[model samples]
Target: MSERVLIAGCGDLGQRVAQLLLARGDEVYALRRHPPALNNSSIHWLCADVARAETLSNLPAGITQLIYLPTPGGREEEAYRSVFVDGLQHMLAALTESPLRRVLFVSSSAVYGEHGDEWVDERTPPAPLGFNGKVLLEAEQWLSTQPVRSVVLRLAGLYGPGRMQLIERLRAGLVHAPRGHWANRIHVDDAASAIAHLVELREPQALYLGVDDTPLPLNELYGSLAALIGAPAVPEGPAPAGLGSKRLSNARLHASGFRVRWPDARAGYAKLLDTQ
Candidate 1:
């Protein structure tokens, strides 16, 4: 059956998910504070700030599925809270009476603190080290208490198409990575597909880690990416703050039957570099 889906805080990832849902003949209503001109004409765009409850009062009725994919304005606690925790609260309150069946809440793997090369999965308890992960975990817990069914996908680093900040850094000799820290990532396309997959899944689990099959050391990842793009070697530096060394496992998501197109970051980066 076709579904009427509402994507709150629709941004890059949300737009991608909308395209997938549209291709499957589902009705997609995307809500954003300032919606840009869309390439897909079939998408129904709603201009509203998820952070502002008043603006979300008239969301589309009968939204069978909801995808919350908001990006924080800044790295501060207030910024994360406004978007993830408060924004989700307001969006859900507005849709309190709608026929919403499922919510695919886009979260981050940062919720798990440093695991020191240990494999972390859905079964691992979350120990967020930064305000970003802390707030997201709070939102996830809050959503679980709601009456509606929900799926929280804690994504790893995203790279693909137009996401070339890291590549630019490598080219500029500003790139650095810790030799011992681990890194996890997922291509943006695969992340979008995972969102679409879980939304339509007959029976979905409560939480899943959205990541590629391969987990590489930070230095190795940077080195390979630099070589792939014919850029300068990356310098050994401190690992990204608050993103502890950990190898994330996507076994549960794979068990659910959704396959990633870019299972390896090297190949994924190579394909992306080819177009450069």
Candidate 2:
């Protein structure tokens, strides 16, 4: 029996997960607002908005697995709540009738508010520094109460492919060495692969911290990237702070039998530069 997978909020990462699921012979239904331009025969792109219960009328029936990875539009409190809290509530209600087996919810590492270089894992309590983390934590709480088997991956700063904000900032000279900061990231492909791996697992833990083995400080990470692009590295000095520093651990994710293709920022950035 083929498992019918429903990917809610099917954006870039969702698209990659869809490709992975299709390649593994699963029936994937991609739910999104603007229709996706993908041409996979095994995947179905349904026009529906997760935030709006009215639009999710024709969802595929009997979804065995659910992937909820909605990207809130703006950086405001209302925007975050609308997507993470209210939006999830609406989707959960709509899917109550469907036969849901498992759920893979993509969350952010922003939930941790620590600014120091402390190593945080799945067991560490999340104290989000801003509304972003607060709302995501709310969503995770709601997901935890659900009856379906669920795995919530609190992902670190995501980077790869068309999502090259770090590289863009470095190239534009907008990013510089911080006085001292820790930046954790896992390549976007690795993230997608982890979700795909969990989908195949007969049993998985309720939560896993998603990040690479390396947790480099801003100065070293930026320095390596600067060298790769042949750009001058910024000297250590006063830098604006965002998402307080903390080392995110992925030991739990790795134990699940997944290896990152791009282990660190240096290797990942070098791969991107080669393609440029």
Per-residue alpha-carbon lDDT of model 2 for 1-276, expressed as tens digits? 568999988889998999998887899988887875766566788887777888876677888888898877778988888878888878777788899988888898988886587889998888987888888999999889988788898888888889877777777777766756887888899989988888887779999988888999878888888778876676776544557888888898888887888788678878887887
Model 1 worst lDDT run, 10 consecutive residues: 32-41
lDDT of 1 by residue, 1-276 (tens): 999999988888888999999999999999888888754568899999889899988887898999999888887999899989999999989998899899889999989998988999999999999988899999999999998999999999999998989888998889889878999999999999999999999999999999999999999999998987788988888888888899999999999999999999899988888877
* Candidate of highest TM-score: 1
lDDT value, residue 67 of candidate 1: 93
Candidate 2 collision pairs: none
Q: Report lDDT (CA) for all predictions.
A: 0.92, 0.83
Off by over 4 Å in 1: none
Per-model TM-score on C-alpha atoms: 0.97, 0.95
Name the runs in model 2 displaced over 4 angstroms: 37-41
Q: Candidate 1, residue 129: CA error in Å? A: 0.7
